[model samples]
Target chain A: MFRERLAQDAARIQKQFDLVLGALSDVDVTQAMSYATQGGKRLRGFLVLESARMHQVDIDRAIWPATGIEALHAYSLVHDDLPCMDDDDLRRGRPTVHMKWDEGTAVLAGDALHTLAFELCTRPEVGTADIRADLALTLAQASGAQGMVLGQALDIAAETAASPLTLSEITRLQAGKTGALIEWSAGAGARLAQADPAPLRQYAQALGLAFQIADDILDVEGDAEKAGKRLQKDARAGKATFVSLLGLDAAKARASELVDEACAALTGYGASAETLKDAARFVISRDS
Target chain B: MFRERLAQDAARIQKQFDLVLGALSDVDVTQAMSYATQGGKRLRGFLVLESARMHQVDIDRAIWPATGIEALHAYSLVHDDLPCMDDDDLRRGRPTVHMKWDEGTAVLAGDALHTLAFELCTRPEVGTADIRADLALTLAQASGAQGMVLGQALDIAAETAASPLTLSEITRLQAGKTGALIEWSAGAGARLAQADPAPLRQYAQALGLAFQIADDILDVEGDAEKAGKRLQKDARAGKATFVSLLGLDAAKARASELVDEACAALTGYGASAETLKDAARFVISRDS
Candidate 1:
């Protein structure tokens, strides 16, 4: 049931992206934005929709922020895949934005997508103006220098540091890099509902960390074809990862523990949050 | 008086940037963001503040969107200066962000500043929730694919085209590239005050076109040292510009005419708009 719901949510998010980008001129940058936003797992959007479902927010309202988060995520991926950053040629089994087009198109497309995120958030259909402002504000915080960008800068700095980052440093980096967005996604429903987000935030904190650990484990054991991109690059680069810090078995164990904690955090919502708990478990078990 | 007001507003915007970026970790991206935002004409911010003053908005409330526009402008400049983009090495008489730091740092810094723009717009001090959302929504529209990004992409595509852009085509391109943000800045005060923005919008349309024409004229006639960056590159690259399309004499005459139109648009405000008229005159007359 959860897998089916996730698939449905992903399709919905893709449709939202189509609706948004289709309004743009058929230029290279707009086309690149449409291309880059396609084929993601849409986990962030799912978290938003599912959490919104639990909060009983209208799908009409929820979809805006769901699409917004996905757009922001796509922007980050497009920029991260640039030659100056990760330098990856493939993403989701296709050419990266900068590889498919020129770097200038990629940069502009990413930037447009970044603005699209806030644009979607502020759409009147999303809710009262206050809700829209709150969403845009929190998103800026999650994605800006204090959050995702800071994490990325730290990651780049770590690559050239004299020694491998300590486990705590790696955790901090991952929190900013990935955890911030995930937490924001999870908390969106409550923000939209104007309810307390403590439980959802707690759930996402564990789930995001577990997600990263699972990613590290996948780099070690998952098939390159299944992941649809390069694998084990961290190990090759001598970058510290969860698996690098803890033994592989211990890392797996920790991820499982995090999943358990994630599930526990959803106790307040009881069976209504079962799918979200399943999402937590799936984070560690998914091959991709 | 207009020059002094512009200088005062520029310093205020700079201080706001310092306060915002100062809260972040002393990382390369944050430092690069500071450097990139350090110097500029601050014309957009000045427009925001000056228009806000005309509308009787308080400085504390007005400063947010003023700073927001400047941050957005800085983001555009940083990205435009990248090796993959315009490839210029000097800006404001200093090394470009990418030249000062690595490309990754520059990219991240630009991205952070882009987010910071929205963050500033959504601040509580900016206005009520609806007004803040309005500012962010309009900003996203002005800076996104339909506006600034579209202009930039067209400019990039024009580089490799078999023929240079025609007068009408370049006019449309500049409307998106530079005119959108200028219009937004000029209208911000009216938006913040919930007043009609039509007059300010008209004023800015003329002002922005005049500003671009002046830039083209300066590129041909001004000193590189005074311009604080490379000049005459448009002519060298065989790129179509106002001066190329209209000739130096015609371009200057057109700019002067636009400044007159700009000042005429401000007649609704009577003597209160004298400074804005001076601004329009300064747009065409300034050395840099």
Candidate 2:
């Protein structure tokens, strides 16, 4: 049920993204931006909309933040795929922005998308002034130096470190790299509704870690074809990952535990949160 | 007097920026971000503060947006200096982010700083939620595809075009690439005070063009040491710049006309806008 809902939400967000880019001139950067935003699982958007549904927040207002988060995610991917970064050539089974167009287009497209996220967050229809302000502020925090970017920096440094990262260090890195944005996506509804975000925050925290572990597990075991991009590259690079530190079985077990914690954190929402709980469980089972 | 005031404001903004980055633990990205942001003229920051002062907006509140614009400008410069972009090796007489910290660090640092600009925009202490929302939304419009990014993409596309850019094409590109952010900075004061931004907007439209023209003039004739970056490269590349298209004399006359128009836009503010008018005049005379 949750899987289908997530797919549906992803499709809806795709339309939202189209609207955002519809009026843009047919330039390389705009085309690259539109292409970069397409075909993602949009798990973050799903979290935002689902969390909003749980809080009885209107879908109209929720859509902007949902689309915004996904755009931010897409920007991250586009930049990560640059030759100067992870240097990946493919994303979502197609050539990345840098590979398809050029590095300059990719960089500028990612940057435009980055600013677009905040612009969407500040849309007058998103919510009240306070909510808009809060959303923009938190989105910045989630994606900025102390969050995803910091994590990327640490991940890069770890590769060249004299010693391999410890289990805890990997955990810390993943939390920033993957957890921050997920947490922000999950908390969107509570922020929009002006409700207490503690429960949703807890759920997202656990879900984020579980999602990273699942990614590591996939890199170790999943087929690259199904993943739509490179896999097993972490181990090949000799970098410490969740699987490296915990071993396969222990990593799998830890992910399961986190999924359980994620679900339990949503108990306050009762049956309304079943989809989120299912989503948490789905994190470990999905092939991609 | 205006020059000294701009310099003082630049110093104050530099201190504020330091406060933003000082607490982060040592990391490649953090260091790269700091390096990228250092030693700029802080012209945009000066615009924000001076504009805000024109409307009696508190400096305390104005400083956030002022600092935010500088950070955004710094991020643009960092990415602009990427090997796949401008391929520059020095900025403000210091090593470029990619040169000093590697491409990956430069990319991530620029990304983090980009997000930091929005984070600072939504700062609670900056203004009411309405004001913050307005700033964030307008900033996105100014810096995104329809604004600075579009300008950058156009500039890149121009490099390999079969023909050099026409005078009108160059004007349009400059409006986006350089004009958008400057206009936004100039309007910051009006936005903060919720006053009429029309006059300031008109002023900025003229001032921004004059500023770009001055830059082109400097590229043709200024000392590289004072400029702190490479110059005359545009002519070497055979790119059609303002100076190239209009001829040196015509470009100078056009710039003087723009300064006059910029000053004229300040008539609504009377004596309070004398500094801004002086700023307009200074654009054509500065060595760097």
Candidate 1 chain B lDDT trough over 10 residues, lowest sum = B14-23
Candidate 1, residue B69: the lDDT equals 93
Candidate 2 lDDT over B1-288, as tens digits, reads 799999999989988889999977589899888888888788899999999998999999999999999999999999999988899997899889888879888889999889989988889989999999999999999999999999999999999999999999999999999999999999999999988788998999999999999999999999999999999999999999999999999999999999999999999899999999999999899998
Q: What 10-residue stretch in candidate 2 chain B is worst by lDDT? A: B32-41
Query: lDDT (0-100) at residue B10 of candidate 2?
Result: 90
How well is each residue in B161-190 modelled by candidate 1, as lDDT tens digits? 999999999998999999999999999999
Interface Cα RMSD per model, in Å? 0.5, 0.8
Regions of candidate 1 where Cα sits further than 4 Å from its true position: none
lDDT of each: 0.94, 0.92
Q: A-chain TM-score per prediction?
A: 0.99, 0.99
